[model samples]
Target: MELKKSSSKQEEVEEIRTIEKPIDDSFLITWESPTDPKNPKNWPYARRWVQLVIVSVFALLGPMASSMVAPCLDQIAERFHIENSTEKALVLSIYLLVFAISPMISAPLSEIFGRRILLQAGNVIFIVFNMACGLARTKAQMYIFRFLAGFGSATPMGLGSGTISDLFTPEERGRAVAVMSLAPLLGPTIGPVISGFIAEYTTYKWIFWSTTIFSGFVFALSIPFLTETYPKTLLGRKARKLNKIEKTLKYHTEWRLEHIPQRKLVAPALMRPLKMLTTQPVVILCAGYMAIQYGILYLVLTTYPVLWTHDYNERPSIAGLHYIAPGLGLILGSQASGIFIDKTFRFLKKRNNGKMAPEFRVPVILLGTMFFPTGLFVYGWTAKYHTHWIGPDIGAAMFNVGLMLGWRGIQTYLIDTFIIYAASSTAVACCIRSLAAFGFPLFGQTLYDHLGYGWGNSLLAFIVLGSSIITCSILWFGGKRLRAMSDMVIFKDE
Candidate 1:
């Protein structure tokens, strides 16, 4: 009996020693160590929430910079002697073009370098270029600086959702996503309103100067708070630290003479998103739908100033206030989506024997599609007829509501489908949407001129409604089959 007891104690000691040894280089371990405080998932709730808020603030700054100049476009045109409205709108829209394309470079870089570093670095670049915008002496300088600033700003747009995914579980992700998602839409809405008043009180230069100052403050705040959240990068750092300690301890041991193996970084980490973009049918469909919806939004935004100032004879400040209607719609729609997205997931999970498929997000998308064109039609007809101002505002609000709902549905669905590659997937979607934002406004003047506001907007509404209907129908019918068809769905354990 004593011998057996001794053997048991020996085994316990061996197990403890094994646990203390460094993990194998080949083993894939998730960040779940209960003692590892560096793991974001294990962070204190307040700290994690604060980190999320900071990331959201970074997210907000990008969109705010994008749209802050919208209210002051006329003044910019007059100052620079830009006679063409299309040329004036291009200065605003081209920033989005840069936003669309820059992510192709930035997203992959984040995967390689790490999120916090790239995000902070990008902010510095953005701040410099944004300040340059305030000092521009000509239209060329303004255009170039805006584009460069946009390129720097795209980092947050691509990585914000990824940051949330890194910290939150699938069940808790809805609220985090709600907050992250709100930043992009809310920034655009609030930017113009505040910028309008600022422009009214001061000069066009202050718009750029104000954003630069705000960005600098956000950048300063981010330094201590935003730690590296990428799992591979964190693990790599931990391994390096452990290696140094192990080497120091092993100096007196026989094992010290042998060479240590270095971990090989996977190239696929940089290439996976592009692979997914090319091969993933779900990504393609969702991206296409998102692009169309975003294009329509930008088209309306570009035309809004022209309609208010030229048609209604409203001053720049009052015209900018009109954006509030869409702002209200966006908030209402986003809140409703936050509640319903999870509810829909729960209902579908129950229906499918407690298994939830990503396809469950499709139903809300159909509802959004129905409202999209209806809102467009109302706004178009009301504006063309010179109807009551409330009519157009209500129409704008309804359209914004539909845009938010559809956007949230598609975004949640993509994240669910590609949780591991959610950032890149989102980046791909954002790229197309940003392209539309850049290009749609350039043509807005021509579209309205040829067809007038009524038919011009009506045409766009018809196209968007038709596209949404087709895309949603395809997803509603084929989504289950598509999910079943993909190896990703079969492999997903949670």
Candidate 2:
């Protein structure tokens, strides 16, 4: 009897080997070879980019809906006869609340069922309920519709990182992750700009209707093109096909020939993001820093109106234009960081004698740590002293640039570190970050009111500095030691 060596670089080979029986050759099933074109990592660059665009579009729709209603809150309140400020805000915050909760369920399902079904199905749910939000006549109805739509919206956030991992190697994922990660941060900034004009020129209902229409376009476009990328799910399908073609007298199904761990919640195929959150230190720090960055992004979204409308005496439509400042920052940051993160990773890999670790991703965030607080200080004091409007706009752009750079770095690091469970790790990160996005704005008005814009932003800047130091230090200095201890990590080296 003879044995063959599985390819060194193939994930499918690694998965099959993990579950291979030493004594029996009868049970093993795997990809035909390292270069199997069906393997998503082996997919042509054009096809991979198509998947990235589709997934990124799907991911963009969620946050677009989340913040699209921001400029329309007043109109919504007037129509619903709502008087409480908190209740008015809940219409937006409740969506984020559900966004946090639903991913715990969706991420694990992506692991089992594959990415395409969950993503498309989730978009359908978002489309249906988001349109309902436009039709709602009462505050309670608005809250319910928004929450349900958010449940569906969360699917992309939970699963998109894992899809990038599926299609690209660690060396190539940095740029792909940068584009996908930009959607969530950039969407909120761009949302208010669109909605502000709509609310000013037409009915607030158009905001919801407009987003639903765009989402429908995205949903329909994705149907024929998007395909499954999960290796376990793909391999299982391959095994089932082989079993039928070979006409095996003794047959075994994918359920019994498992190469991945299973955890059941309400369904046998479902797993929990909470399990990953509780156990992984890399996830903890990555999610925490991302959360802080997310919280700051939303807080800025809330405060932009105050600076432009009340302080500068601009109309709603005009004030909305300020969002472009941050929007430009996000685009610039993503493009610049995209090029450098991959270069940095390859450089560090060469230095380490062709070994690569997730820690290489952490250095990019050093640029973020500096920009994050400086942007805040500049924005805060510029607004505080009533300097030229361009001064604050520049500051806002700087802040957004920082947020996105950090966001892309942390997300790529998590996907690389927990390669097999990228969805689960990303799901937990979404859970924490969504909570921050929800909670931070609830206090934005009060924080700015009590301390004034200068001091309040300075406070946030200080916190950003502190958190970045703690998170980056742990990852840069101690990440390898921690990976050695973590069972959850899959690509321990590359």
Top candidate, metric TM-score: 2
lDDT of each: 0.75, 0.83
TM for every model, in the order presented, reads 0.86, 0.93
RMSD of each: 7.3, 3.0
Error of 1 at 221 (Å): 1.6
Writing each residue's lDDT as its tens digit, candidate 1 over 1-494 gives: 01111221222221112212234322322333333466665577788888888888888887888888988887899999999877888778878898887666666666556689888988998999999999999999999999999888878888876777567654455667777777887777778877788778889899989988999999999988888876545655555555577664222111221123322223554565566567777777888898998888878876787788899998778988888998898887778777777787778867877555677787778778777788999999999999989999999889888888888788877776765456777888888888877888788888889999899989989998888988888888897666665553321423
Stretches of candidate 1 exceeding 4 Å from the true structure: 1-28, 32-39, 248-270, 480-494
Worst 10 residues of 2 by lDDT: 13-22
